[model samples]
Target: MTGNPAHRRWLMLAIGTGGQTAMTTVLYGLPSLLPAFQREFGLSLAGAGALVSGPILGILLTMVGWGLVADRRGERFALAAGLLPAAAVLSVAAAVRGATALAVLLVLAGACGASVNSASGRLVIGWFPPHRRGIAMGVRQASQPLGVGLAAAVLPPLAEHAGLPAALGCCALLCAAVGGVVLLLAVDPPRPPETGTVRGPGPYRGGRLWRLHGAAALLCVPQFVVAGFALVFLTTARGWPAATAGTVLAVANLAGAGVRLLAGWWSDRVGSRLRPMRLLALATAAAVLLLALGAAAAPPLGTAALLLATALTVSTNGLHNTAVAEHAGPAWAGRALGVHGLGQHAAIVLVPPLTGALVTAHGFAPAYALAAVFPVAAAALLPGEPAAPAGETAAPSLDAASAAPRTPA
Candidate 1:
């Protein structure tokens, strides 16, 4: 931070994105080992579904609590404290014998990880100025997919050799180690201008915030639905091996990582997040529709469509985050971003159990059909213009504040 802000900006980006990559790889990386989980537990698909649902439900319950803490305490403390316990929780996840204990461990892990997202987003936004924040956040968004890619490439082999529990334990240790590094290396960015004690305009004052909220909720459905079911669909329906499904998911994550950067860069150069958001939503809608059609079609065609949809559906992640960041401003950015995150977590929490039920009853086709509508509905609801194009986002340099919000290192 003492050096030029621009140079420091890249450092902050690396830490924030790096932490996201690690946490997501550990948290959401379970699908790659579903077959073994089923075999070991002697469980049905529905019973195994909780492995995905547990963490999300924890996230659902705790994100806003983290937001409030971020607003009051600061991102650095929130992140450090959050990461410290992750090792223990994940250790429990590794050692737990019963399904109930595993679910409880996952729920604790998810709740702990929830703080990482809010604290991390604040960290990135704290570092970059408004104009360049898109690309910064986009790169930050890439961390999730990057983590997934790492999991895909590493987890299968690791699980094959050491067993899933030991692999998870390894991941937990890595997260704690990285968390310590971030706590030491990452610094909050300087705020640009001074913010007075005056109350700034807030999202709660108008309908705009509500609109974005609804849109995020809708847009999140397709992404989460695809995430929840993609591997299962490929494995169960296409008759592909579990390893092959893991490979496809890995590939899909790589594609998603690329799109995250493109989406952010487009927002940076094109001068708006909303327009690109619409295009992304439309593409996601088309992708989801094609995905549904592909499900019933040839295996190869279905695979291609599913991969395409996975990339597009997940691609909007950065755009949506940046849009929410731009709208929320520095004053309530923590809370706004927390609420926005809440939307994603809510979908993640609700969708898996529902998807499992859907798969159990009417089957996956209807599930995909229902999931495809979410992004379309999101696209339909998006305004031609984002709420705060520029005026409201004015923020003081992070260094100037009594409590500077540190980006997650």
Candidate 2:
């Protein structure tokens, strides 16, 4: 559909959000299905926990490659290429017999799906003006929690009744459907014209990006810890039914989605993304500590704390992503975001098993208490108000080239 430029921009945002949701369904869905996998396969908590990290490991391995492809080619091509293969692999994975084979397939599928992370962010930075990008990217970032919410709401029942294959097939179907939609609708923004003069050092050649990456990695530890274990904790430790725990986690994910949007909008209004991100990191630490205390004292209180922690822990992602894109600029946004994503996914890959071991040995209290430390460290590590991009203020700069529409790359 062709229409007002604003309409097209919004449409791109919607498409990007949809693509993210579709891919993340499988990644986040694994957690919801983990209990069922454990029962069916007679697996240990740590062994079952490995499934949660497998896809993230896949994402870590290929994110940079996908980012490079998006930078060299275009966002649309990278997104479609990634989703198609991921969909195919996930479909096959649904039919695999052994847990080992299934885990391998999930990891491979995740590697393919990593394409959406960089390409989608690049699309937002390229299409939206700097002033409005925070909210737009926030809405885009909501796709992650939205996908997790969907998984928590839908996959548990499907896995319980129809079995693992049905749940996995559902993820495959979502990826394929979203991939088709992205292929039809996604259009990359025009590339900025290059000046003939020799360029200075690249965006990645700075300490700022590395600092952001480090903070993102540390902050992600709490998010993954909460997400990976919440349902299982409720079901096994607290004596709640699977469906009840899934519903609670699903509601928390939904609330987290709204918080993500607000965080993005707040960053825009404040003219500094890092400020809000830093604040959220501190809040997440407090929330997790409270959650650990509540877990030991009262189950209901602990559940409330868990919900609050989920929202606080996840609220920073959009702001962090938008800052990375703005700093990288359109030319390097893909690769830069890829690097940013690598740090976060690497944390995801590591956090699950480590947390699971803690849960297996000590209990949820120790696991959550340990998780709190990372976000506090992230808050300390976060750079103060980011330096403005060259020739522009800290508030994202909207120039003529970025504002103008051109043929998709």
Candidate 3:
């Protein structure tokens, strides 16, 4: 449908948000279904943990490729290509008889679903001007927690009553529906005019991009640590009932979603993305440490700590994502976003099993304590200003512009 430019941009934002929510419902949703899988498959904590990480491992394999495709072919094509096939695979996966087969299919689905990660974000960057990007990206980032919250609220009981397949089938249906909407409505902004024949170094050659990618990866550890095990830890370690724990985590996810939007708006006000990200890293570290201490000393305190930590840890995502897109510039934004996605998904693949091992050996406290290190490292390691791409003017600062009133034209 045609509309005013501002309305069109917001529509694009809504579409991107919907697509991200659907994909992440299957991606982050896996953990909420893990307990059921553990029982059905007679799996240990680590094996069930593998089920949580398998799709991320698949995402790690293909994120960069999808980003490249988005750069060349546009966001709509990349997303449709990924989502439709991935949904089909996930739907078929639910019917598989063995956990091994299901895990394999989920991994394949993850590979396909990686299409949305870079493409959707790039769509936001393209459609919205720099002044509004932080808030737009924040709205986009909210989809993950929203998806996870949906899974937390709906999946466990559905799995308990109908079986794991039904829960999985629900995710697949949602993905398919979102895919159809994206294909019908997604429209990429016109490409900016190229300035010169001379080409600069690729995104991977830049130390700034690499640093951002690394920092994003490191910071993701705490988020994944909580997402992977929060419900299980609450039920098994703190002795809360499973349903009660699920509800708590769901509420935490909702709170985290709100924090993400706030963080994005805050970044816009601050005029620099990296500054807010570094601050968020410090907050995340403190939250993780508090969670560790609380888990050890008091169950009631620990539950509160868990929700606080979830909000702090997950809030940085939209800020970092907007930073990457801006730093990469219009030319390479898609591929750069892909590389960032690769790093984050790689962390997701590795963190669950490592944290699971720590939990099996010591407890949630040590695992969380170890997770605290990554955010501190991220804060320390994050780069200052990113270099602009060759021949391109720097984007205007939203915060600075908003502070000054415009004269009448």
On lDDT, who's better, 2 or 3?
Answer: 2
Task: Give one digit per residue, the lDDT tens place, for model 3 in 1-409.
Answer: 6656567778888989999999998887788877898888998888888887878988999999999999899889998998899899989988987988988998998999999999999888787767678888999999999889888888898899898889889989998998999889988765665678887876555487789899999988899898879888888978887788788888889999999998888877866788888998999999889989988887778788888997888899998888888777777888989999998888778777777778998989999888999999999889875544587534432222221112221
Candidate 3 segments exceeding 4 Å error: 194-196, 203-206, 386-409
Segments of candidate 1 deviating more than 4 angstroms: 191-196, 386-409
How high is the CA lDDT of each candidate model? 0.74, 0.86, 0.84
**Model 3: how far is 396 from its true place, Å?**
6.3
Cα lDDT tens digits, model 1, 71-143, are 6677777777777687678887888777788888888888888887887888887777656777888899988
Q: What is the C-alpha local distance difference test score of candidate 3?
A: 0.84
Q: What overall lDDT, based on C-alpha atoms, would model 2 receive against the true structure?
A: 0.86
Tens digit of lDDT per residue, candidate 2, span 1-409?
A: 5777767887888889999999989766688888888877888888888876788889998999999999988989999999989999999998987888988998999999999999988887778776677888899999999898889889999999998889999999999998999899988876788778886677766487888899999988899888888888888878989898888888999999999999988987888889899888999999999999988888788888998997888899998898888877776788889999998987778677777888888889988998999999988888776566688667753352653364232
Candidates by TM-score, descending order: 2, 3, 1
Model 2 misses residue 50 by how many Å?
A: 0.6
TM-score of predicted structure 1: 0.90
The TM-score, computed over Cα atoms with residue i paired to residue i, of candidate 3 is 0.93
User: Which of the two, 1 or 3, has more TM-score?
Assistant: 3
